[model samples]
Target chain A: MDTVISAEDLTKKFGDFTAVDRISFEVFQGEIFGFLGANGAGKTTAMKMLTGLLRPTSGQAQVAGFDVYRQPELIKQHIGYMSQRFSLYEDLTVRENIEFYGGIYGLTFKEIRRKIPQLLHELGLLEVERQLVKSLPLGWKQRLAFSIALIHEPRIVFLDEPTGGVDPITRRQFWETIYQSAAMGVTIFVTTHYMDEAEYCHRVSMMAQGKIAALGPPKQLKQAFQAQSMDEIFLSIARGAK
Target chain B: MRTIFFILRKEFRQIFRHRVMLPMIFLMPIIQLLILSNAADFEVRNIYLHVVDRDLSPASRRLIGQFAASRHFVLTQTSFSAELGFRDLEANDADLVLEIPADFEKKLLRENEASLHLNVNAINATKAGLGQAYASAIIRDFNNNLRMEWLDMPDRQNPGRFDITHSFWFNPDLNYKAFMVPGILVMLVTLVGLFLAGINVVKEKEIGTIEQINVTPIHKSQFIVGKLLPFWIIANIELGMGLAFGKLVFHIPIAGSLWVVFGFAAIYLLVVLGMGLLISTVTETQQQSMFIAYFVLVVFIMMSGLFTPIESMPGWAQKVTWFNPIAYFVDVMRMVLLKGSGWYEIRQHVYAMLAMALAINTLAVLNYRKVGA
Candidate 1:
């Protein structure tokens, strides 16, 4: 399979501190790649570099066959992103938010009209299309945000802790959407703190203090650490002093 | 361009949906236009005068009547003693005092020259000077009449032999309301456009929606254009309403083309909205944005000659007014509305406003950070 994302010695620094140390990784097409880290473990910084939102201070990264530094605009056109926070406009209705994001991706009005029904139906959001996003529950907003992110049908979707404050059942449902997208030959590069959700990925890279501490499938990571579960494997690897 | 349109539509929808901001956006300008136009007058009229006529003579009475007959002064109170008139001045009930000598026209007849005591309150010294000048003119006219009566001539046009005629071009009547209404309209546009646009983006930053846009495929210029266009339209609508009120309610004349006023308003709105975007780019919170905007606006409005004449300001201050877009717009509106100035007369001001708009927008876009990090 072709590599959808490849970062060669990716690094980022802010003034005196290194937020993302030199690290390299690859994500194949249609693979759900989980980036697991603690609060300040540089997961967000790395993902930002990949999405062309921030320039890497050193080394290089490519997404959808475009250099991150030189071709950031072209890279942006083929990728979708959802932040950890509720990023949809609360005052706008669900359908309006979809239309806005779709428009930003350069989708024509006719294309947006064609995509809205299918997107809404898949997210189970057709009934609440007219409601303000603020009035919806957190779980539903998360789903809506994800749906909006994928409005342009990009090749890769970068989700930074997409299910941070959601409930367990809603999180399970959200993963179902992620899995469904991955099955359709779209790569998923997700960052999360939840170990159970990390287990759902095809491969995982656990980061600690701006460095990649471990990288493998969930079961392989567990076996390599001689642990019972992915949770123990994460704690054992992350607990050691940097 | 298409992305900008989308953003603009979203912003407009949000502004329209918010019930509280809608009234504030429309009503505040109208109310300010009504109150400020009335309050912000340069022509001093109906000045309260306290008179102490100890002489109780016909000459003194006639002199006092001259002041009263002139529409500028009203004899609010009269006292037999100077001490009583001073008391009234202290109480703020009177603005000026005219004290007549007790000799009862004896000095004028004997010496052929007499002087009356004129005491004026110095607080709000500008108004006091005007009041004193008006009183002095009245006394001079009375003296001239007395000289004519004593000579028993048909006309005493021997010595001075000069006629001075003054004419105001734009505002023939020199109505202060006519001068201020258009300037106040410009101020309202600047205040609303800059403050709301600055605070709106800062609110998004505080709420984290700005981060969402920062990471998206949306270009920074597109975002900036989208953010400012709604405010641009709203500001123009406000200009229209203010012009209508000025014409119908205040009886202000619109001597120039309405298109000229609107064209200037359109360019001026961009300058102010760009200023707001610059403020938003530097400030982190909505409160900080508003406070900074207020500080900048106060300076701009003061220097814009909204209340005082720009030409009367110090030379350095007058030079600074050239850069203030509010000054250009105010001057343009007043010239167009009152003077009937055409494109040639106001072309410099129009070009200056356009340059300011372009410069401010360029600076704002340059200062704007495309990436959050």
Candidate 2:
């Protein structure tokens, strides 16, 4: 397996408070990696460092074969990002949002035009492609945001609580899309609070107090912790830190 | 470059699609040019006057007629009692009260001098000062006429006198509208820069769209340029329309080359755009941006010599005007429009504004961080 993302004791500190401690991890290409942590456990901060949106205070990291410290802009060209919030332009229509992102990422107008029909069809937004994004349902907007993040065909897509505030059925459907993207050779590095969803990840890493308490597949982690569910494993790890 | 074009298209689409922006763009310059230009006129006129004619003589009547004949003062009341005229002044019914004593004409013929008591309202200091000046001029004219009629004083009055006649240049009428409309263009462009480029960028930060944009391959300068170019163009168009309106409506003279005015304005707007860019990069919310913009704008406008002459301000305040961005443009507007000044005359201001643009825009670009601090 080819490793696409590698970190060596990546850390970030804001003033006196340490948001992400000296910790390390790796993700193979075309694999689903779940980054699990409780609220304020530094999941979002760690993700920011990896996506070139923040500078690490200490240690080193590499994204898409580019140094996080030296080549963040080059790293930007190879990676896609989605945040917890709805980040698409609310005033812009569905198609304009796609074209805008595609254009900024250096896609030709002909390429964007060819990609729109299939992209909209896959997101089930073909009917409302011309409507303002604010007018779309929340589920549609989320899906469209995810698709727009992948508009440039990035090698690794960072999903930060992408399925947050989504209903259970929609969350499952969103995972199917994530699984499909991974199957097509896109590395999925996602952070979520949903423990059951972590069970679906090929490998899961549980963070507690800015440190990774456990790192393994869900089945192995469940057996190693003697827990029946991934939720129990997270609860035991969080308790052990205290 | 291509990315900037995309962002520019997006910005223009968003600006055009905004419901309030269209109206604000259309009505702001028009309303500012119409209402503010007319409202900001400081020339005092139509003063209400009440008179007490106790003498009831030809001289006293002639004095009253002189006051009435002048366009500045309106004769509101004329009575035999000085107390009645004072009451009118006290009741706010009259701006000034003139009381002629019973021996006013008798003393003038006997002693060649008679004192006329005048009461003036000083509530509005400018109006009061100007009104007093106009009244004194009329009185001085009446005194000169009275002396000219005295045949006995001919040898005394025959002494050589230095006569001074002054004529106003550029705008000979000294029309306030001609001056105000050009100043109004400065104000209009400033508002567009502050609210559009400044507030608009902060709004993206407020709505979390900037987070998405930051992660893209777009460069920081590209984003700032995209935000600035659209509003910069819009402000210039508004200025052009405002200048045309000034010519058509207020008949303000455009004595200098339009190219010089626009050239100075083009550079001046970079200073303003840099300010807006700096403001947006430092602030995170539209409200905070607005507060800062208002704070800067109020001080800059007040110190800009827009409403009052900068020379009239205290020494420290006049020194402060050197740093005020709007002051340079206000002076440029008046200089180019009213004085028919060419580039050589306004070159110093252009150099100052260019230095300001370089310093401010460099600061803005430096302050803008695509990554988190």
Candidate 3:
């Protein structure tokens, strides 16, 4: 398979402190790659560097065939990012939010108009299309946010803990959306603390103290560590780091 | 170009959708412009005077009559003892006390000179000073009249008197509202543009939406221009509303071309809104942005020559006004509204505003970063 993202010795330093230490990894085309870490393991920092939202202090990385240091703008054009906060304009209506994101990605007015009904129908939000986002339930908002993030049809989509605070059933439903997107040959790079979600990823990388502790498929990682489940694998790795 | 339009459209939708913000934007400025213009008037009138006449002669009676006849002075009390007038001054009932010496007419005819004690209460310095000036002017006019009558000149109307006629131009009646309404309109527009633009970006940061936008492919200049243009349009609309209120309610004449006022305003708002965006870039929280904008705006408005004339300010203080964007607008507003000044008369102010608009917007654009550190 073709490689969509590749990084070597990626590091980020703020003053005297290093946030993301020499972490290295590669993401393949149409593959669901899970980036796992405990809190403060520099997962978000690494994600930022990958999406061109931030620059690395000393590293060699490429995203969508563009260098992160020199061609960040080009990298930005090819990737979609959804933060842990579920980035959607809470004040705007659902239809307006879709059009806004579509427009920001260079879609014309006529194009946005054509895409709106289809997007609302796909998200099962046709009835509430005119409703303000702030009035929607958390589950609906999260689903809408995911759909809007993918509006530009970028080469890769990054989900930074896309399901942070939600019921299990909604989260399971959200995973189905990710699976479908991945099935359509859209690469998914996601970060999560939920072990069950990690098991769903084709491959998972566990980060500890700004370093990659493990990288492999869930079953392979479980068998190699002699653990029964992904939770035990993460706990053992975290304890070993300490 | 298309990206900027989308941003602008989104911003307009968000601003109008906010229920509380919508009314506050339109109503607050109109109400403030109406009420504050009346309060901002510097015209002082109705000085209360306590007169103590020691001389019961006709001369002393004539002087007291003159003070009573003057429109500015209200004869609050008449007393024989200076102590009574001094007591009135202490009670804040009287602004000034006029004491005529005994035999004041006898001394004026015999010695050709007579002095009277004018005791003034210096509390509320501006009122007291103005009261004293009005009192002195009445007395001088009375002296001139008495000289003409006493000399018994053949030509009573032309008694070698040099009449220095005071002519008030522009606002012939010296209406304070005409002067302050335009300045207030400028202030309201500046405030709306500055504070609104300042709070907008910081609010996005606080709510974590900025990260989503930063990851998009939009250019920084396109983003800044998009954010600024909507507010610029809203502020100008508010200015139009204020101008209508000034004209219909206050009857302030628009002496110059209305287009000139609008042209200056369009450019001036760029500087003010750019200041707001610049403050937002430096601050992480909306509260911090509010405080910083408040601090800078207070300094700017106070020195903007809105109520006080810049010519009356000290040389050093006046020099500092050259850098204040609000000062330029206030100057332009007054010149265009009251003096009917055309482009040629107000070109210096326009040039200053253009330079400020360029410098401030450029600095703000440079300071705003689409990427995180």
Candidate 4:
């Protein structure tokens, strides 16, 4: 397997508060690597470092063979990010939003024109392509945002609570989309609090209080903890931290 | 370059798609400019005056006639007692009271001069000052008329008279609309450009779309340029509309080259747009940016010499105007439109604006790093 992301003792501090401590992890290409943590467990900060949105206070990280400290711009070109807040322009039409992102990533006009129809078809949004994004339901908007993130065909896609506040059926479709992308050899580094979602990942890393407490496949973690389910394993880890 | 174009297209689409945006940007400001040009007039007329003529002589009667003859003062009441005339002023029935002394004609003949008591209501200081000036000017004219009547007498001592009449140059008619429309146009353009650009970036922060853009490979300069061009274009279009209204409706002359005026506007808008971006740097939401921009803009517009003359301001306030870009534009617009000032006359302003544009835009771009990206 190919290692697409590698971090060693990456840390971020805001004054005396450590948002993300000296943490180390490696995400391989074409695998669903779940980053599980409770709220304020430093998952978002760690992901920000990997996505090149933030600089580490200490230590190092390599995203798609580009150094986080030295070549954050190049790293940005190789990774796609979907933040938790549904990052599509609400006032713009769905097609315009996709075109905007495509242009930002330096896609040619001909390429953008060709990709729009196919993207809309994949998301089953061809009927509402011209509708304003604000008029769309939350689930459809989230899906469209995700599809736009992949327009550049980046090697790795970072999903930070991508399914938050989405309906359960759309959440299933969202997971199906993630699975399809992973099947096509695109690495998925996702952060979620749902233990059931963690069980679906090839491997999961649980963080507590700015530090990773456990790292392994869910079944292995469950067996090691002598727990019946991934939820119990996460509870035991969180309880041990407290 | 094509990337900037796409961003521009998206921005334009979003701005026009808002249902209230077209009217708010184009219609409302134009309406306000039309109304304010007529409403914010400096021409003060029809000041109410009360007359107290104790002499009851031909001199006093003719003096009262002169006050009634002029266009500025309206003789609202006539009384014999000074106390009665002052009571009219107190009741707000009169703006001023003019009292001729009982020995008015005798004093002028023996002493070559006579004094009259003129009391003015000092509330609403501008109107009071203007009303007092009008009264003094009429009195001065009456004194000259009496002096001319004495010159008609053969056996009279002819004194040398040095009379000064102010001929208002450039605007000979002293047209209030002509003086103010250009300044009002500058204010409207500043308001549109400043608020639109200021609110735009902070709105992205509030909605969290900035994070998505930060992860893209878009360069900082490219992003800044993309954000700037749309509002710049829209503001220019609004300027064109306002200029048309000023010319067609108000008949305000454009004495200098239109291109020269637009040339200054092009650079001045950079400073204003930079101010908008800078406001976004310290603010977290659209509401905070609005409050800060308005607070800053009120200070800027007041010192911009819109209605009041900057030359008359105090020393410290005048010094503050050196750092104000709106003051420069206000001065430029008036100089170009009213005085036929061309590029050579306004070159120093262009240089100053270029320096400000470079400084402010650099600071704004440096501060706007997607929250320290």
Candidate 4: where are CA atoms >4 Å away?
B56-58, B84-93, B105-112, B147-151, B154-159, B371-373
Per-residue lDDT tens digits for candidate 4, residues A1-242, read 89999999999998899988899999999999999988888999899988888888998899999999989999999999998987999899899999999999999999999999999999999999999899999999889988888999999999998888877788889899999999999999999877778988999999988998889998899888898998997887788778
Q: Lowest-scoring 10 consecutive residues by lDDT in candidate 1 chain B?
A: B153-162
Encode model 1's per-residue lDDT on B178-255: one tens digit a residue: 888989999998889999999988988888888778767788888988998899989999989988998899999999
Better by DockQ, candidate 3 or 2: 2
Q: Which stretches of candidate 3 lie over 4 Å from their true place?
A: B56-58, B79-91, B102-112, B148-160
i-RMS for every candidate (Å) is 1.6, 0.8, 0.9, 1.6
Clashing pairs in model 3, backbone N/Cα/C closer than 3 A? none
Clashes of each: 0, 0, 0, 0
* Docking level of model 4: medium
lDDT of each: 0.89, 0.90, 0.90, 0.90
- Residue lDDT tens for model 3, B1-373: 9999899999999999899998889999989987898888776678899998888888778888999998888999988999999999999989999998887888877776688889999988788888888889988877766766776654446757566889999989899999899998988998899899999989888999989999999999988888888889999999999999999999998999999999999989999998999999999998999999999989988998986678989999999999999999988998998899999998998899889889988888889987777
- Least accurate stretch of 10 residues (summed lDDT) in model 3 chain A? A77-86
Share of reference contacts kept by candidate 2:
0.83
Error of 4 at A227 (Å): 1.6
lDDT (10s digit) by residue, model 2, range B244-345: 999999899999999998998899889998998899998989888988998998889888889999999999999999888899999999999999999999
Q: How well is candidate 4 docked (DockQ)?
A: 0.71
Taking all chains together, the TM-score of candidate 3 against the true structure is 0.95
Tens digits of lDDT, candidate 3, A1-242: 99999999999998988888898999999999999988988899999999988889998999989999999998888998898985999999999999999999988888889889998998999999999899999988988888888898888999999999888999999999999999998999999989999999999999998889999999999999999999999999888878
TM-score of each: 0.94, 0.96, 0.95, 0.96
| Candidate 2 residue runs with Cα over 4 Å from true position | A239-242, B52-54, B77-93, B150-157, B160-162
